[model samples]
Target: MASWDVIVIGSGAGGAPVAERLAAAGMNVLVLERGKRFTKAQFEDRDEIEWCRRDRFVPSILTDPHTRRADEAAKAMPTTDGWISSILGGGTIHMSGFFLRARPEDTKLGSRLKEQGTTGHSAVDWAVPFDDIARYYPTVEDEMGVSGIAGGKLAPLAEHPMANRAEATAKKLGLPIERTPRAILTAARPDDDRAACAYRLVCASYGCPNDARGSMLVTYLRRGEKSGKVTVWTEALVTKLEKAGPDRVSGVRVKRLDNGGVEETVTAGVVVLACGAIESARLLLLSGEGFNPGGNVGKNLWFSLYVDVNAWFPKATMPEVMTGSPFIHRSLMVGGALKADEQKTLGLDRAGMLDLLWQHDNPIHRAERLAIEGGGTLWGRALKERIKQHFTEGRSMLCEGFGESIPHAGAYVDLDPATKDQHGLPVARLTYAHHPRDRKVAEHLAKTGLAILKDMGGQNAFVRVGIGETLILQGGTTRFGDEAKDSVTSPAGLVHGLKNLYVTDGGVLPSSMTAPGTLTIVANALRVAAGIVKQAGAARP
Candidate 1:
């Protein structure tokens, strides 16, 4: 059996930072990833079918299926909804890189709900205050080469021609809008070998061929390898965590995907699970009952609620819409705390942010939408004419609103009793139903966004609420808290009953904030690494 001081599973934003920190601290670290390690040359292709339509990033749902339902009463059906990337750097490899920080109020959601007299929700304040994690944000930004102003953290990329007009419109309407910070590099740095952004505009679901986006594969994983103490095993799936005693994880059992059904047991002094929220929770439940003393292993799973509002502008009115620049780069965060009237009318606690961006440029997606709108019968000359009009007549702007989904008793994940994977292991089953207040918050934000688009001279401004959960930003399954009775992990990210088992992913987050959870996950991973290093040093003597 191969042994190491620490074994970190899943080299995403969460695992990579901790692995790099531990290796830099002179501890031998092993990282096991379930996906293949593709080189920069492999990611250079720009095929929409390979990157977006196919199962290159995510697993094939037909084989490794997950079942989902609105509630426990309904029979769960097979779905591909919650799968993020199963690659070397996980979802960060194909992310849009909207690196926004969580507001201070987001850290103390339990206190905010209590103050507002909100009931029947499972929201909890973080074990540590936001300031404890704030100090690590700059480290993440600096290492990832985030491009933005120092104090304001908002620098608009000059590639987008529509930014000036959007800013002017927001200012005229007395709405507060700020430029968003992205993880993509604006200029080539001195020490880094990666190139600057090419403004290709096919960012969200496509891998960056130029390495401009600061994915963990190109950043922390590379740094960890340079430390000479970190070893990464790609295409390795950890199936179970073996226990040393009542409160210690001895090692992990791994299955090699590249090999033909080869399995091995590897020992480690410590184990860290960073396989995002869904898979991390599934692994714990599969390991047995020893790690579930609190019975809180797979509970309180929450996903960010997404509300999309789109508006169309004619080419004659807004000529900038036809400029072919996909960067809008603006966000509306003016609705901070809810006013007295808003609270009374909407029955909500707070408001969320509205991110403005140009509509996706996928031709297939646009054609499908047109086909659906034309009753699925638009073909031949009509379809060609519609496609031309869709491109030349006008362009659509999208305002994506991200709101907090309050964790409730109804939303969670567990092992499916009937559905098993190709390896005969039980698959993860998700039971989710949005809180009623989630729709209200989303609707409020959508209305605000719609008004902004109309103010900007948008012709067909409309709002679409309750577009379901944003699975990529999920969290709270193994939430960390001060007490073991309610949370699966401690404030330092250690599992409740295990001394050496930790979770350094979004699963340890207690609440899903209004913004993306990637930055917070990275910052918290650094904080957890510090705690582990300090503990290791104290035990050395």
Candidate 2:
């Protein structure tokens, strides 16, 4: 059996940074990825249908074998919205290409809502503050070759600290634009020997071939492999965690997906689950041998309910093709309480509160084009008529909001006793239901989005409330806190039960923050790696 100092599962936004930092620090690290690894040159750009289809990013009954339902009564069958990305580089390889630093207010989750009369909400602050992550933010950016300008009104208000190539155009259009901090490298570094950003706009949902976007294959894994301290096993799905003693986790059992039925074992001193939220929680629940007593191992699920609104302009604005907006335009990013009646009117209960916006690329362009071509066949003609009407009198926009799904006693992820994966372990069962708080946020964000679109020159910016389902950005399970009994992890991301076990993914977040968790995840990993190093040094004789 192969053994290592640390074994990190999953290679997503959270896991990559931690693995790189640990490996670079001279620790033997083994990164086990459930999915196959692909380099930048291997990323497919020709299959727009497969790429645009939500199933491409997530398991659509092939790998995962399960689908989500709106509710228990809604056939209790399968459906998907494709929020998560499974890959060697995780979602960063196929991100929206907009890199944003968390604003101060984004960190101060509780305070921001109270100012907007959003009372009775349970938004909690992050375990670590923005100042704690500030230095690491730039460090990760530099390593990732993040291209951005240095100032913005969103996130940190003080002279924003990044720039992007698209900043000038959005500014001239009088839009709330700033220099977008991107995960793409704008220039070359002396040591890395990687290519730089080519200023191509086709980064969203596609990996950059020029080694620009700082995907994990180029950043963390690259550095780790170079150190010869990190061994990454692709398509190695860890099915179970083996326990050597009451206080120790000895190794993990894996099922090699490529061979289809081979199982192997690898031992490690410490195991860090960096799998995405859902997979991490499911893996924990499946590893029943581990030290989880509270059964809170897979509770506190959270996801942002996305809302999209598109307007067809008299002329093609093609906002979606443009790079991400630099400024977050906080006027629309509000969260808080709402009257019951108000929630019902705006379809808030069904869609969740959403942030508003006036631009975004809708992948349904082909369908929209069919309608614009005057194909008066069945609903086709009506679609074309609507397209024509919008072409002359309408515009395209998208408003989306991430509703906070607070931890609940009922909502959790567990091992499905009924279904098993190819490895004979129980598959993940999600017992999630939408919370009223999220619905309120969705409703409020939707209404606010429509208003913003109007203000931005949309005559009739309507609410195309997204399909309201409890999607999984997935974490808050195995949450970190001050006390072990109250949470699974410490503030520094060490598991409360095991001294060496650390969680460097969304699973360890204190609670949901309004900010995009990618940068925060990387920042926290840096902190955790530093702590591990410090602890190791303190242990030396």
lDDT of 2: 0.61
Q: Which residue segments of model 2 deviate by more than 4 Å?
A: 54-56, 66-76, 79-83, 103-130, 151-179, 188-196, 199-201, 316-395, 466-472
Off by over 4 Å in 1: 150-156, 339-341, 373-380
lDDT of each: 0.84, 0.61
Q: Which candidate leads the pack in TM-score?
A: 1
Clash count list over all predictions: 0, 28
Question: Which consecutive 10 residues in model 1 have the weakest lDDT in total?
Answer: 149-158
Give the true-structure RMSD of model 2.
6.2
lDDT of 2 by residue, 1-541 (tens): 8889888888877877778888877789998887777766566353566666656666555446543444445333433432366678788777754455555544555554455444443445565666876668878776676665364222221121112212332244333443335566656654876765554434456766777667787888888888898888888888877788776788788878778758899988778878866677777777775556355676665564455554333333433322343223232322333346654564332222333233423335544544443335435566766655554443454556555554555455665556665456665666666555566555565655555555444445565554354354557777776665556777777766677677888777755554355776777778888887777778779
